[model samples]
Target: MAHVRRDKKKLLTRIRRIAGQVAALERAMETEADCSDVLIQIAATKGAMHALMMEVLAGHLSEHVVAGKTERGRAEEARTIMELLAKYAR
Candidate 1:
């Protein structure tokens, strides 16, 4: 779950789109579409999933790494999450 928890509405919307993308991929396979077309859809789905992940990660950082930090521990958790987010973005 990559630590970010988004609002219900945003989560649901992203999930719905991912589900539709999955269905589309399946249908494309069933219809024997071009390999390129199927791959393109797969990439689109991946991009959507990544966007959702970023949203959730941001939320997690806000609530946990920032709000939960102490004066002495502030740098530690914030740095950890920033590193993780950078890695994920890459």
Candidate 2:
């Protein structure tokens, strides 16, 4: 997780921005903004999330996945990556 610590500040910044976007999206819904506009906001939020996911995945690949020695460890790493991909690839 030391690698994670290196990017912690940048990651938190992205997370906070995403939070703000979500709040704005909620407010837009409450105010009954145009449907198209809301959908655009949703797309932006999803994109931001994907960027964050990639950063995490990159860190994992470099710090653990590639260097994992045991078959079980590699399998676990692959499973984790696949699960996230499947969930997000919907």
Candidate 3:
């Protein structure tokens, strides 16, 4: 989790932005915004979430998988990442 610690500020900033997007989306829904407007908000929120996931995934790959000293450990990490990716893709 050292890499997470190093990038904590950046990650937190992204999380905060995502939260704002979610709030906006909620407000749009509450106000009965136009369908197109609501869709745009939804897309924006989804993109923000994907971006955050990607950033964390990249960090995990670099810090945990690629940096692993043993082949078995790296393989296990890779399998875990693949599982996560499969779930996320769904």
Q: Which stretches of candidate 2 lie over 4 Å from their true place?
A: 69-72
lDDT of 1 by residue, 1-90 (tens): 334233787788889999999999999999999999999999999999898888877777677667774855667878878788788768
> Candidate 3, clashing residue pairs?
none
Q: How close is candidate 2 to the true structure, as a TM-score?
A: 0.86
lDDT of 2 by residue, 17-87 (tens): 99999998999999999999999999999999889989988898877778888878888988988898899
lDDT of 3 by residue, 44-75 (tens): 99999999999899999998899988999999
- Report the Cα lDDT for residue 47, model 3: 98
Per-model lDDT:
0.81, 0.89, 0.94
> Which candidate achieves the best TM-score against the true structure?
3
Q: Which 10 successive residues of model 3 have the least lDDT summed?
A: 1-10
For residue 54, give model 1's deviation from the true position in Å: 0.5
Which structure among the candidates has the greatest lDDT?
3
- Quality of model 3 by C-alpha lDDT: 0.94
* Candidate 2 lDDT for residue 20: 92
